[model samples]
Target: MVVRTEWRLRQQSPRFKPQRRQAVSLTSRWIIGLLTAVYLLWLLVRTVGQPDWLTQLPALVSELLRLVEIGWLATLLVLWGLVWWHERQEAGQRLPPLKLEELYNLHPADFERYVARLFRQKGYKAAVRGRSGDLGVDLVLTRQGGKRAIVQCKRYRNTIGPDIVRELYGTLIHEGVSHAFLVTTADISESARAWAQGKPMTLIDGPTLVAIARSLQLSPPSSPKAS
Candidate 1:
């Protein structure tokens, strides 16, 4: 018998929070302005100290000032680049924030929507059949060149066992699908993983789901909705 239980998505790290709009911090603006003033003061001090060069030729003074301006501009550019690099590195280290829909509260039918959104973003034509009468298979996605797949979305917190894998294999044969995808927010049993090793089925666990969420850039659902 096939047992069905509700599964919740794993709790996400705060670092993965997504920003809805862009806004500059007051502190950052203040720091930038302060640094600009300091650079200008330094240039003035340096120009005043070089009396010998200034007295030699008035035209050379203009050239010297131009060079100083160029140097200051280059310095600002370099600083901006460094700041950008640092922010990007932090973003890389931080986890992408997930929405309510991405969580475990999603229904089995909702799995089809998530899968379609993910695969469609990758330039594939996918259809969601989650509401169909199939117990194990939730979706049927077809790619170009006559390739078709059967997919099962398990939103269970408990580890998937060999029986589930066996059931999918049976459905794959029954449906005559070339590939099968069994995805869940929880881990799969060793036996289940082993059972899928020599088969056409692909098993995706919790970690894999996070990776997919990051790759596809799916926005987290603000409110939990029934699948």
Candidate 2:
């Protein structure tokens, strides 16, 4: 199954990587704009109050205008640089599907991302929902024929138990998905494997995950550039 999407891969800049905060950038811009306006107003009022107001108005206004231009230009440049830095950092951190040992080293959120990418590479439309309050579903996978499956990723050394498998089954029913996938970095207990048998569920352990990663001919999904 070769799942297809509109994303294309781009080379990442290796210089720097930073976490992005869109709100902070927007707030900074607003602050600069407000300060610029107040400064210009103050300059105008000070010029008007001078004894030879008319004589000095031209020079004062010209200087004020130039100052505003320079301030705005510098602010814009700094904002652009911040945006570029964050984007580059994100791009640089996109790792290819590698060894299971390497997968074990990833943050839990990053592990979810890795699993989503893995499924996408295997021809499934996968979306990551590994956030707080996301229910038990981590990644939702849709097949070409419109069949849907929900995935739960566990990236830890703890053995997967029947309870977890059973919980995913309940989630599968609730979500109305056709199947459930429980991917874990550790081994699945015998009871857990037995519980999943004859059910619409698949358990992927560390070895199996590593095997899949090794077999893949990766064409990673594109990360949209910040506007």
lDDT string, candidate 1, 35-123, tens digits: 78888786777577765655577887779877988887787777667666644443333234244346465544544455545554544
Candidate 2: tens digits of C-alpha lDDT, residues 57-83? 788786886787678667766866775
Number of backbone collisions per candidate, in order? 6, 2
- Model 2 clash pairs are 3-123, 17-89
The alpha-carbon deviation from the true structure for residue 192 of candidate 2, after best TM-score superposition, in angstroms, is 0.5
Query: Model 1 Cα displacement at 116 (Å)?
Result: 2.1
> All models: lDDT?
0.64, 0.69
